[model samples]
Target: MQQTKRIAIIAHNNKKNDVLEWAKFNRFFLAQHELYATGTTGKLLEQEIGIPVHKLQSGPLGGDQQIGAKISMQEIDILIFFWDPLEPQPHDPDVKALLRIAVVWNIPIACNRASADFLITSPLMRVEYQPYLPDYQEYLNHNYDQQTTKVRQEQPVSLDTA
Candidate 1:
C-alpha cells in the first residue's frame, strides 16, 4: 500500500498569495496526499488548484487550535505554515501552540516556500519514514500522580474528640 501523507496548509493574510503560488507550482505533488487548510486558504486552494481541501475555521476563529488538536492526535503528518513574521497576528498564541504541538509530535513542518519545496522533494516524502516520538504517557501519569498527592496533602484532617 502506498503511504499517503495528511498535510495541513496554513498561511497568514499577507502570505496567502505566496502560499497559493507555491501550491499551484506543487499541485501535482500535493494531489497525491490528503490536504487540509484554514478556511480562506482552503477555499482559495480548492478554487484555484482544483484540489479537495478539508477546511477548518478561520485562524482567529479557532482554526489554529483545531489544527493543533489534530497534531496532538496524530491526524496530521505534515504542516505547511506560511506565517507572516513581520506582522503581528491577533491569534499569535494559537499559531505558536500549533507549531509547538507539531514539534512535540515530531511531525515534518515547513514554515516557508523554501522549506516546503525541500520537504516535498525529499525522498522520504514518497516513502514511509518513522519519526522518533517521545512517550508522553509517562509525563501525563507523573503529572496526575503529583496532582493526586497535592490534593491528598491539602485535605482537611478530621478531628474527632468525644
Candidate 2:
C-alpha cells in the first residue's frame, strides 16, 4: 500500500486560476493524498474541485510561515507553489523564506505547472521515497560552538589588582 502524502498548494492572486485548472485536471489523483492550502486557495479548491483542503491563514497573514513551519517539522512532503514572478508581493520575504525552508528540508517543490506535471506523473510520488534531509540539530550545535569560540576569542583578559 502506498503511503498517503501530505501536499501543500499555494498560488499568487494572478495564478489562482491556473492552479485551479491544474487541480481540476488532477483532481482524482489529488483526492488520494492529503491537501493543504492558504485561505483563499483552499476555499476555492474545496468549493470548485469538491476536494477537502486544510486551510491555513492567508499568505499575507502568516500562511507562508505556517507552511514553512510544517516543512521544518517534516509534516509536509510536497509543495506546489504557483508564484507570479512578474508581480511583486507584499509578503515577498515570507514567500522566499517558505521556499528556502522547503529546500532546506529537502521537500519536493513545484514552482510552476511544468514542474508540477513532472512531479505528479512521477512514480515516486505514489511510493515511499526517502529524501535526504540536513540535520538541523547538528547545524545548530555547530553554530553554537562557533559562537562560543568567537566570544571567548573576543573577551579581554582582566589585569591583576582588580
Candidate 3:
C-alpha cells in the first residue's frame, strides 16, 4: 500500500452521525487518502470532508458486498466501519461477509471511533507498507462435488441491485 491509502468508510443508520463527527474531526488525515463510502454515508462524508468519495449502494442494498469485492481485489487498503452492534440489521449477512473479506485480505479494519482514530493516526498510514497476502491458489484448485459445482456455475452471484 502507498502512503496515500485507499480507505473505505461505512456507517450503520444509527451510527451515521457519530461517523460523520469522527470524519469531520479527522478531515485532515482523511483528505490525504482516496475515500470510499456507501450510499448516504458517502454523500454526508463528501459534504463534511469536502473531498470526492467513491460511493457504492446502501448496505442493505449491496454496498457491503461492494466493499467486500473491492477488498478482495485489493482496491481498498483500510476499512472504517461504524456498525451498530446492538441493533439487528436486515442485511446482517452482507456485513459479516464484508468483515470476513477484510480479514481474508489482511487489511486494517476499524469498527469504532476509537479504533478509527488509532488507525488514522497510525504512523503506518504515512508510509508505503506491503501486507502479506495469503495464497489462495490451492483453495481454488481443490475439486468440489460435481453437483455443487454445476449448481454454482449455473447460478452465478450478481452484485447488482438494480
Candidate 4:
C-alpha cells in the first residue's frame, strides 16, 4: 500500500553481527524507509540497533524464499544480504535464488556492509524509481489469471449419494 521503497536485510551466521553493527551505526539513515529481514536477523537488528524490521523465517528454512517471492512480486526495492564468504551453506540454493531474483527485478542489492553503507546514504533511494522500471506484471500474471478463470468456470458439485 505504501509507495516508499522496501528494503530487505538478510545475513549469514558469520555476518549477522556485522550487519547488526552496521545497521546500528546507520540507524538514522535506515529509519526513513520500510525494513524487512530474516527472523533472527530482524530480531537481532531490533535488539541491537533499535530499528524495527518485518521478520521472515530463517534463511536455511525458507526465509530467503519468502523474500524472493516478495522480490518477484516487485514488493522489494533494495536487498542487503551480508553473506559469509568463508563458509559454505547447505541452503545456498535458496540464497542464490534470492540474489538472482533481486537481479531479475532490477532491485538494488548490497551484499556487504560497505555496499549497504553506500546504499543507505545514496540520494536516489529517497526518490521514486518506478518510472525507470519496465512493465512486468502482465507477464507475471498470465498463469494466475488463467488459473483463476478456470476455477471460476468450474461449478461446485455437491455429493448427493448417501
Highest-scoring model, TM-score = 1
Q: Candidate 3: deviation at residue 155, Å? A: 20
Residue range 50-160, candidate 2, lDDT tens digits: 989999999999999999999888889999999999999999999999999999988889999999999999999878888887777988999999999999999998887
Q: lDDT score, residue 52, model 2?
A: 94
How do all models score by TM-score?
Answer: 0.95, 0.91, 0.87, 0.79
Tens digit per residue, CA lDDT, model 1, 2-60: 37899999999999999999999999999999999999999999998999999999999
Off by over 4 Å in 4: 1-3, 135-162
Worst 10 residues of 4 by lDDT: 127-136
lDDT of 4: 0.86
Q: In model 1, where do residues sit more than 4 Å from their true spots?
A: none
Residue-level lDDT of model 4, residues 1-162, one tens digit each, is: 234678899999999889988988888877878899998998998888776789999898899999999988878888999999899999999988999888877888899988988876777777766535666688769978998989988968768877
For candidate 3, write residues 53-108 as lDDT tens digits. Answer: 99999989999999999999999999999999999999999999999999999999
Error of 1 at 89 (Å): 0.5
Evaluated against the true structure, the overall lDDT of model 1 is: 0.94
